[model samples]
Target chain A: MAGAGMKDRQSRMSRPKRLRKTLKIPAIFFALSLAGLIWALLVDGSSDGLAALAAGSPLMALLWALLYRRQ
Target chain B: MSANMIKRMAWVHKWTSLICTIFLLMLCLTGLPLIFHDEIDDALNPSHWVPAHPDGAMLELDRILEIALQHRPDDVPIFMSFDTDRPVVNVTTGARPDVAATAMHFASFDRTSGDLVPPPDNGAAIMDFLLQIHTDLFLGLPGMLFLGAMGLIFLAAILSGILLYAPFMRKLDFGTVRASRSPRLKWLDYHNLLGVMTAAWVLVVGGTGVINTLAIPIIDFWKHTELADLIEPHGAPPSPVALHSLDDAMAKAKAAVSDMVLQFVAFPGASFSTDHHYAIYFHGKTPLTRQMTIPALIDARDGRFAGLRPMPWYVKTLALSQPLHFGDYGGLPLKIIWAVLDLITIIVLGSGLYLWLGKGGQRMDPAMEPLWQGPE
Candidate 1:
């Protein structure tokens, strides 16, 4: 019974470790979204192709996140 | 951070958010429709009318003003603005030069043919209703100031929310919405996630919004302080008199800033001009610089060139903030991004309200509740 209790504690602790591993891709995508928005503002021309990338990347990231809910 | 500090911050986050949520929600919803206002207006009133003369030269500014005056003989022309894509000139006339915007009459005329352009029934009434409510709750400057105060509170709430995020997420991973948990906890997690994701945008928009609400005062200050020298040369305010040729004034203005294009002309005694000058405002040809205006003051009596005064930093900030807040500069796709973010804000506001209400029967976390609740 004591061994089982110790195992339960270890499992709880390991879940966060697992979460950290899964977080990498989504976290990078999220950072990309923020960077893209800032870049969009800094660009000189209006509605330029680069501006489109800056604006579209966040929505794409959002879609990706929604599709892969675990991340 | 200590638990006590987190508790104090949470207390602040709750009350500030609770106070401004409804107003912020209204702003977000109203603002969503406004984001596509140009597209909506175009769809409603398709521009089927063409320029009267496709090949002919545009009539002189003086001729356009004369034609506009003929339409409203009793009213004086307060402002004249040029359209970007067409040979149409928009003339704003009022009972007096200093008349308020609500009392002003606006009409468009073809500069080439000197003919009145048919006004489109563009659902302007509904749009104006929404705009007035969104701008000032129909209470003019006072309402604008009240909303500005609310914006400050909303900003405070956002800051406190961010501060609390670190503590709340200490035990959990980022974006971890526990759907299987109690509904309140689920929404709480969502609120945190969305809140953090949108923190930058909300800060920019909210901060800009607060600045926008102070527009009237800022312009007034500019007129009184920075523009005092310009107006001082004229001495006592001049009485109404026959104005000089607008075409000559525009020509002189063109000479001053040949690279830029004339955007608008504020006649004497107009809010944007001195009592004795025609403030000819010009904008750069480029996309970004077009948002920044350069005003050249022309003596209204003689159409002589007065000095061009560059706008101060604050005024420039106000101009830039207007577009950034609207997200209109980057075109349709940017508007879509703005709309999605706006919807997310609405959800955040709604879920926040839900969480607060759901806490009604449950025992309140003493740390989360305000100090006045006393050991609860």
Candidate 2:
């Protein structure tokens, strides 16, 4: 039902709307970034151990890359 | 997932990742060679350390400690490590556990003759330099903290990237690399495919790395809490405590806890010690849990067992996570795997930047300035 509704909505929207929809991806990403920052400030200060965040970048890139690729 | 929210998040992820990508790339590159450090060192300087005759008598830890202290009576022995290749004993002594203190001493003794081995000309100075460079680029604690902040940002980018993945893939199939398209699209496709596939490994390494950075605080907390109780009511400020027999302490600690191997020792006033006890640290024998240490406080006064305190489960997990993140524990093969993964990471970082920049048609318009750059 939800998928059908989304399809209907997609058909109704203009072409630009489809491209613009992809843009929402970033906003959600940034909110998460904010949450991570707040958590780090509150819980643990910067240390070698916290390097996990930086280390996660490649994987993050890979993840997003897979999502955006054309069929 | 709202339009406004996605734009903001994309901005955050792009800028954050871009800022640290160069330095991170350097880290991965340098780290690649460093992973096989032990093997490289062995290959370059062979015969520096060789085993004594199998029939030769081995020196006891007690005698070695006495000899070590003879050179620096003021300082206390912090650690005693066995030589892997040679029958020599390496002893590290320090005036105090604080990093600021300079009155430190290191010595090696022959296992057979119990004679002091001369310092190697190439001392550990080079290794120490590499370590400092790897850790903070010689910027001390501030540099470390700065990198940590950057790491936090990078992590944000990662999680945000993951969230973005679902929507991006909503219309696309997994592993759809469009190599026939523009260079940017091809690279982008490769990046996504590689990144998602290695997601688990990356997350584990990254998350653990973040946790590992808290080592200083964790040790500080442990010292403040566990060691504090053991130190108070210092019996006469621990009168140069007649250096207790290390063998005995080892035996007692082993007897107290079965299925554990002795990792190292922390003398009184050392980083892991109280004023009145020599902390004998032991770690699990298993491959997975070997890094997790359990310290037994041995009263320096009488060489009697003082107390045994196991690390909290979280702390133990932290201990285990570090080696896993660094990929140094298993062997050279594992280090090779780690390096390959690191290279994959670099490609992913570069491809992501390419995709973000190649957006719309104009690659780099001077009119539209980059919002940010890496820390100066």
Instruction: Please tell me which predicted candidate would have the highest TM-score against the true structure.
Output: 1
- Residue B374 of model 2: what lDDT? 12
Evaluated at residue B208, the lDDT of candidate 2 is: 68
Clashes (candidate 1): 0
True contacts kept of each: 0.13, 0.14
Off by over 4 Å in 1: A1-38, A41-49, A52-67, B233-241, B364-376
lDDT per residue as tens, model 1, A1-71: 75367436544665446445434444564565556555655565553446656544545554544444322
Predicted model 2 interface RMSD = 11.5
Scored by lDDT, model 1 comes in at: 0.77
- Candidate 2 per-residue lDDT, tens place, A19-61, comes to 4563354334344433332232223223322333433334465
The TM-score of candidate 2 is 0.74
User: Residue-wise lDDT of candidate 1 within B1-376, one digit each (tens)?
Assistant: 4567777887889899999999999999889989898988888899889988889998988888888888898988899998889889999999988776678999999988989898765887777777788889988899999999999999999999877765554444446665666666767767877776677677778888999998888888888887897777676554433788888888888888878878999988888888889999998866667778989988888777888878898888888788778888776777888898889889888998898888888985443333233221
Quick one: best DockQ, which candidate? 1
lDDT of 2 by residue, B3-27 (tens): 5566677677778888877766766
